[model samples]
Target: MRPTDIETLVQVGRPTIAPDGAFAIFATSRPSIEANRSLSRLWRVDLPAGSPRPLTRGSGDRAPQLSPSGDVVGFLRPDTDGRTQLFVVEASGGEPVQVTDRALGVMSFAWAPDGGSLVFVSPVGERGRYGDVDGLGPDAESPRRITGIRWHANGAGYIVDRPTHLFVVDTPDLDAEPLVSPAPAVRPEGAPAPTARVVPNEARALTSGELSYGSPVFAADGHGLFALVSEIERDRADLRSRVVEVSLDAAGASERVVVDRDANLTVDDLIVTPAGDLALLASSVGDSGTDFVAACIGLHVRRDGAWIPLTDPETIDLGDPGSHVTALADGSFLAQSRTRGRVQLIRVTADGAIEVLRDDVEVTGHAATRDGATIVAAVADVTSFGELELVRFSGEGVGRRITALGRTPIAAIPSEREVAGRDGYPVHGWVAVPEGEGPFPVILQIHGGPYAHYGVHLFDETQVLVAAGYAVVYANPRGSAGYGRAHGRSIRHRMGTVDFADVIDFLDAAIEADSRLDGSRVGVMGGSYGGYLTAWTIAHDHRFAAAIVERGFLDPVSFAGTSDIGSFFGDEYVGVDPVEIEAQSPMAAVSLVRTPTLVVHSELDFRCPLEQATRYYTALKRQGVDAEMLVFPGENHELTRAGSPRHRVERFEAVL
Candidate 1:
């Protein structure tokens, strides 16, 4: 084993198991040196034997899902025009067939109930072309006319021209190939090489109009199609979504089913159980003077056309609100939840009993077997990346590891520790120390999402820092997820102050415990909320020797005006008053900072916007502080993680 370098770390996407649980398929991505980008390919692994092989050798294939019949696997890949389209190949190796050829390309898809067709979502312009360069064909270089508040997204640039809609494409049944072969492609030589039928996979628009529809789920009976539809609102920030049902063959007629008692709630996920019950996760929007917080995930079940609460109203939030639930037979569901700074598999029984199925490792992706007795999950820990594994419900949740996949980046496991905080709250964290080192420079890494946490999972940046002979330390502050709602929302009005103290306390405690850590040579770095705190730390305390702030906010008032989520973020995260926001801003105290800082920003980042970096850099220069700015072109806020491979390597190099 070798130390995991920054560039070679492979990324894993969704992993779906076959219906019979005989095999599983997943997407693997690696940075391409020639293209200066990332390329993904689909791979398959036989169960029990765990013999893994490449299923599709394409430039970028992702989102692998096995059909109900388990004969074919469907994935998304780009066409010649750079549009991502749906592709299907035999579960047994063969040439993949392009299933959909829409103009804009498919975003995501689900296998139809009969497995003869696929329901997919594609972004289309108002005039019905699939994002065809403002309906002027694929090669048109036209001016982007922005019309609304939510016109552009961070990573996905301009989105107002084309709102994503639902469409269904018919697929041809594949012939079964012999599963056992001597090699990857062992077809009989000169035996009439099999050719894919050139079928017309013209997609039909299932739903139409200006509003967007997503998370399309088919009824168990295959008659009704349910999805979350967002209606056009005067207030662009108000994403008041509801569960709507439409006939699978219908084209625009949809009936809303109130999943939330209050229509002001945002319906994130929708799933149709085997029993025809509509299970959805809804989050309430605070309207009164109370500080808006992430309330308990409201699990609703629609019975007899009326939605009713299935889980207790006060049910503990399964931690990660963005994680979807996989419904099992008899109405029970499995969800990936965060607890105590680690990812766990949580099972919500039909009667609403939440049980921790797997508590030791990070279960990133999972799929249920046809019998619903077993789950094939992609599990990873701090020292390793994702690998396919089988987890039986009858066991103690410590499933059997199946495929080793690729080499793990971490040569050694990170050590876990806890620091006592206010009111007996324990701040949990992990530290990865480099080998052959004494009093190493410490890189205090912070995670984003203020609501998202860093735990016992494989983080590439942390490994990269450790591999570079730096001691990496990260902890879950007061505002991170995995803890209950109170802890997650504790930094709502006090984002920089409370969370800053928690991190400082944890860092000091860690330094006190380890004699080989050079606390005086400490550098702080973070993205998004972590970036916000990084700037906050340099402003308040001058202990940090260097700082790297990636896509972070410096002025709350300017951020509230420029960010896509600016409309509601101030009301939700920070205090609404202008005076308080200015006081909390890092820009307000630039004269007090005396540390070398690196400001990284993306050109297309609409979340925090490029102004954040520019303003912060301007202040650093005006104050005559040591500062350098790196502006990534053709990238967004997710530049560090999902940007081009060459860029990711350069980012680490710059930070080092």
Candidate 2:
């Protein structure tokens, strides 16, 4: 496990079981150095035997799904036009046939229950009242009208004129060649075949208007689709989302509101069960200190005709950071969530009982069989990379791993340790020591999210650091997810004060417990929120030898005005007022830093933005402090983790 071997690792995702439960298909991505990009391909594994092989070739192939009939598998791939179009191949073996040839590309798609067609969402240019598209194209260069605060995203870029909408395409007829093309059709001078003139069952738009749809899901009976839509006014302080039911048969039809937006709740990730019951993940939307930025699973039973909150808002979290849900045959739902420091699967019973199904490993992707008898998940811990694991559930909410699919051998594992925060709250962390060492130089890495948590997962950055002969220390402090709501909410409105103290306390505990860590030769580094802590730590304390700050907010005032989520990030996380945010900003004391700092930033990172790094570096240099800056062009905030393998390795080399 050398630092350069990071490029050779195969990252697996979306382990979906086939309809018949004969095998499983998943998305695997690895770096292609020749192309200078990551190639994601689909792979299949025999169910009981767990023998693995490639199912699709080339790059940009992802989101593979075995059709309901179990004869064909559907996936998304980029065509010659660079637009992601639907493609399907025989379940046994054959060449894949291209389906839709849309210009903007399909963002997401789901197969119908009856296996007739697929409902997909793709970006469409904004249209006038008369339904004429305003001038927008794949190569059009024009000024985009700026009207909304959340108009541009970090990775997605400016989304002003183009918005995503829902459409349906027949998958069966997609294999046949079209009857007409630019080359001209063989028809008599005056006689023309009407239906034959156009491709049969052409893609139809089921949704329209100035709105955006996310992850549309088909109903169990295939009558309609349920999806989260952003129809509320964008100028509002907080963006609102609600679930809408779209009719598959009607064009430009009125959609029914399945779940209306509540004053304090943001609902998303809608899933429908075989019983027709709707389940959604909802989080509290507010600037209150106890606001639940992380959502919990909510259930809406059709029989009762009302939505009921399944998990406790203040006590239970969704185990994971994002909103995700999977419905079962018996009307129960499974979601990835964290309890203390490990992300696991939790089952929300049909009767409203919350139980932890598996709690030892970090489950990233999971899918269940139609009958809910077996489950397959992509799991990993501190010791290994993500691999497909067979999971079985029994009575009383207990689960066990049956087998590992394509498991990668690990060289070393981190030792878990518990330390008390300055306020006496328990903080969990892991320390990775080198093979032969005494008082080794240590690198303390803090995780971002201030809302996100670091679990027992195999973090590449940690592994690479350890491979470079440096002991790495990572932890889940206060404000991290998986330890319940109070633990996360504790850092809200407090920011650098509480979490900073927790990090210092954990470092002291680590130094006292282990004799191999060199307490005097320590380097600090972090990204996003962790970046904020690093800047703050070096400013307040002078013990660090070097510091690395990657895409972190140095000034809350500038961030509140420039960041895409700036309007609400500081107000909700730090405080409701601008004054409170300014007081807690790391920039307030950045001039006090005297350590050699290396600043890493992505040019296109709209979340933290490049100005954050530039302003801090300029300040540090002006103070005559030893400092350097590394800026990655055309990259976003995720550069440290999901960026190019070349850049990731270069970042580690610079850190060392």
Cα lDDT, model 1, residue 584:
77
| Residue range 329-381, candidate 1, lDDT tens digits | 76788877667766677778877788776777777777776456767777777
- Give one digit per residue, the lDDT tens place, for model 2 in 434-532: 778577899889999887877787777777777777888888888887777777877778888878888888888898788999899999999999999
Looking at candidate 1, the ten consecutive residues that score lowest on lDDT are: 175-184
Native-to-model Cα distance after best TM-score fit, residue 432 in candidate 2, in Å: 0.8
* Model 2 poorest 10 in a row by lDDT: 394-403
Candidate 2 residue-wise lDDT at 210: 74
TM-score of each: 0.90, 0.91
Q: Look at candidate 2 and give me any clashing residue pairs.
A: 319-337, 319-338, 320-337
Q: lDDT of all predictions, in order shown?
A: 0.75, 0.76
State model 2's lDDT: 0.76
